[model samples]
Target: MTPDDQPFRPISVFTDIAIEARDIVRGDAHQEIPGVRVEEHQARGVRVTEVEIFEESAERLMGKPRGHYITLDVPTFKERDPELRQRLTGMLTDQLKTVIPQDPQKSILVVGLGNWNATPDALGPRVVDRILVTRHLNQIVPEDLRDRMRAVAAVAPGVLGTTGIETLDMIRGIVDQTRPDVVVAIDALAARNLDRLLGSVQIADTGIHPGSGVGNRRQGLTETSLGVPVIAIGVCTVVQSISIAQEAVQLLVEELAEDVTLYKILREMTPAEQRGLVEEVLGSRFQDLMVTPKEIDVLIDDMADVLAEALNRALQPQLDRQEWT
Candidate 1:
């Protein structure tokens, strides 16, 4: 088919790594706009996908920013296998260490962004409760022990609905007061694919948009905005209803193309056209619905444990190793 035969497409609204990775996996060599680089790897059965949008142009195209985005896919994290859990934790700590500043003495602030009352949004708050907070302990600990341990502090700023305060504003105020060298923000994210929900963790140095996962985007917390390096860690806890319906229609079109005349007609249409048609039919019904797993409460607890363990180890590796050994 000629280039002109392609249908006009709407930009994707999903804020997950897999959507961007799809273009590369489909063998679309030119799909990557200039200034973007992607790399993939495997660590102990987990798939690690990394996408770097290096310039404003590429950032605009990806709808992210000029920083590194890393996604770790471990579909069986909820299974709670000891060995697998340990491996995943190790992988998470390794990735986090890469983005975090290397200064051993630098103070680090951990910001958990979410509403605790909602299970799907409680991942962050739960994680904060599990982190190894040493900032307060540093003052009373012996000099040698205190010197060896990094200063770490954590906070879970409740959502605007409860506090009537913008989450970013709270963080900014804390950042100004604490003067932390780096800020690590954790929150629940929304994925475009159901397979990604509850099975993936994303770490980025580009900062985070509170509530972006469920499409209620708020002001972003970033290095430029906060005057400190921000490292964001998130787990996909929900998927949009439109994405589910769109994928179902695509599957149906593929399955029936060989025999059904109508399916054959759809098969001849450009991908954009197919998606457009699907949206026209399903958009109104599915637009605002966000779907999560039936076992989200259990899954959120499991994820919070995993993420908290990883962050604890990453932020206090020296102390963590000493304790474990």
Candidate 2:
């Protein structure tokens, strides 16, 4: 059958899925989960949830040693709210700073987890790109202004490259060379749903898997494997195609482009126009297979900046408290 002979395609929309606190695994006394009163929901196809299990919420939590493990559900570039994103960043930063160890001479190893070439899985690389990497600062800035930061290095392990090094091996080598205080890993994650494209960022004290984005799970990067404490931060960037279809429908409900607004405009459209504009734009091509417009690049940049800031803030206190005590 010819293209025009095909019937009008039906659009699919995705919505939030919900979860309760009782269903999630709880951390041990020493391995506690922070920000409890846990709840779960879905956005797009990404799982959205919140928890508050910190042992010391208002007291030494900020001053004492601790770790942060978090995950965020951000569904779309077009849908992200700047204010909400910043607020989440700030909360994660505050919690992480409270738990990180303080020591000026101590070092930190950061791993950017995920494949860089894929846009949906590039959150890890994008975050590391914006970091104030301490190791490189000495070459660019005067020694006096370098602050108390002892050392910092960022790495992204290629999944199939000839490098042939495992995530654990790379981190172990860094730990052996630097003997740093801690390690922080940033990675992209799969949510049960698809809505969390850019609206959330999660931070956790536990370890991480390097190539979880593409479903290649090797040995995980955690404290036990490297003999060093590990903290993980992640954002859910991909979701189900059904959710994408839903978002497109919502967009049409509120606004219409001048060219496509008129049923008359649509009436006059040729087969080529229908296929190029309405059918494609409102179909899976816009939602699933492609990255849509160029503005999404900006959204990724913003997410990277927010994550980097949160990581830096979490580490700043350790930089400050290093020599004092």
Candidate 3:
């Protein structure tokens, strides 16, 4: 049996976070999915969920790779409260360390994978702007002065549209030359729920596919392609327009239920049927559209700063050890 009760919506399902996909899969598929493990905990007031898929069957069932996915859900992240900000950053730092190889000497190449020109898709570039780059610091700064920082490099490779070069190709070239032991990629992701946008971060060992969130497919940056371990950090920056419409329609139906005929019809339809009806009404033009929040301009910067701080803490082994102790 498939993870989901209904026939999976292929394109739409890909846009959801791995945890959301797991939630949908948990209904009636089985009491549990073999080779898949899920654990949840609270850290610094944030909900952290870790999903581990140990076998090919589990990987195929989840539509994610055979590795680990850690998600941090803190919807208030968009509000820009400084105290809350530090807490979430600390949580993200701890989760990031789990996926990264436990080697103090591992040099890291942080690849920011998104279009810098578009604010909604610019999480990668924005984080790179604030991240502490220390790969070149060894020659000039003394070890003690820099707190024994690891060699860390960062790059924001523009999308194929602007640079006319495949993102993977550019990163592969960098990896070949820099020879970093691991690559951490950051990108904007799309979620089915509006609340998750600008509020959730999903980190995975499966790397990432540029433009996949918006239904535009590109070659994925995975371990096999990059010849190194890859840890992808994704922040939900947009939500599918169709999902917004779906919620609106549901609310309208529920509010107008005194009229019964339409309410009964909707109640009789399956989720797939409801989504299909919404799609038909929305037509093909709006199918691929994704949306961001009204205050994205300010929130994006705040999010970038938080992610940069977390990356800094996670990438530096000396700092990571100090804090964990």
> Which candidate wins on TM-score?
1
Against the true structure, candidate 1 has what lDDT?
0.81
For residues 203-310, write the lDDT of model 3, one tens digit per residue.
998888888867787899999999998999999999989889877777767777567788778866766577779989894877788889999988888889888988
TM-score of model 1 (CA atoms): 0.91
By lDDT, the candidates rank as 3, 1, 2
Write model 2 residue lDDT over 1-325, tens digit each, in one string: 7854433221112211111111212211223234334556554344445544455441122221233333445444355666666666666676566556656556787778766786666778888776656776656755555565556777776444445777678778878887767888877654433445555566656577654433455687778888888877776655545334544543554465444656446545543344346445555444334222245467766778777877776665544433322
Looking at model 2, which ten-residue stretch has the lowest summed lDDT? 15-24
In model 2, which runs have C-alpha deviations exceeding 4 angstroms? 1-77, 80-82, 136-147, 240-296, 318-325
Would you give me the overall lDDT of model 3?
0.81
lDDT of 2 at 256: 59
Candidate 2 structure lDDT: 0.56
Query: Model-by-model lDDT, in order?
Result: 0.81, 0.56, 0.81
The residue pairs that clash in candidate 3, if any, are none
TM-scores for every predicted model: 0.91, 0.58, 0.89
**In candidate 1, where is summed lDDT lowest over 10 consecutive residues?**
19-28
Report how far off residue 259 is in candidate 1 (Å).
Answer: 3.5
User: Which lDDT tens digits does candidate 1 get at residues 195-276?
Assistant: 7888899998889998865668899999999999999999999888888877776787889999999889988876556667
Worst 10 residues of 3 by lDDT: 3-12
